[model samples]
Target: MAKRKFKKQIYRYECTMTGEAFKTTREAPNPNDLVSVKAYYELNPDEDDRPEEIKKQLQTEE
Candidate 1:
């Protein structure tokens, strides 16, 4: 068994918990070190898929 190393590429990412954005090296940081988007989707699989679904709801509400 061996460990996989991630490429160091600078990019902006948001803190899912604080809503604060910043730049970092890793493309996919450790979920334990940060937050997991997959957790939210797994917990609420049926929730609206954001801007698209949310926009549709607003249009229907108009």
Candidate 2:
């Protein structure tokens, strides 16, 4: 007797920004599975500078 092999199928998706593509399985993704993709543009300052920076910004806004 001989055993048989099965072929699995795959699905793919693309990112709107970079036009880069990737693959996925399980047919379709659920609404909850989708993630928000955002870019990080802010940098953390030194610990001492953080408090003063926040205070200055708030005071200027007032």
Candidate 3:
């Protein structure tokens, strides 16, 4: 078998209070929950170039 490389997506999140920048592979569940948003930054992040996370909650509503 041959080796294969998979590209993992990275996301950037911010803490509305501290104004900190963080990176994560998955979207933050309940991004509106500002408390959880701050907690996300407490975790470790990947060391690769990743795209920024976009919040589309406002656009999806009719």
Measured by TM-score, the strongest candidate is: 3
Residue 23 of candidate 2: its Cα lDDT? 69
RMSD (CA, Å), each prediction: 12.6, 12.5, 13.2
Question: How far does residue 52 in candidate 3 sit from its true spot (Å)?
Answer: 36
lDDT tens digits, residue span 19-42, model 3? 667678998886554433424433
| Better-scoring candidate (TM-score), 1 or 2 | 2
Q: What local lDDT does model 3 show for residue 48?
A: 25
Candidate 1 deviant stretches above 4 angstroms: 1-8, 29-62
Model 3 Cα displacement at 2 (Å)? 2.2
Which stretches of model 2 miss by more than 4 angstroms?
Answer: 30-62
Quick one: ranking by TM-score, best first?
3, 2, 1
lDDT of 1 at 17: 66
lDDT of each: 0.62, 0.50, 0.55
Residue 12's lDDT within candidate 2 is 67
Estimated TM-score for each candidate:
0.30, 0.36, 0.44
Residue pairs with clashing backbones, model 1: none
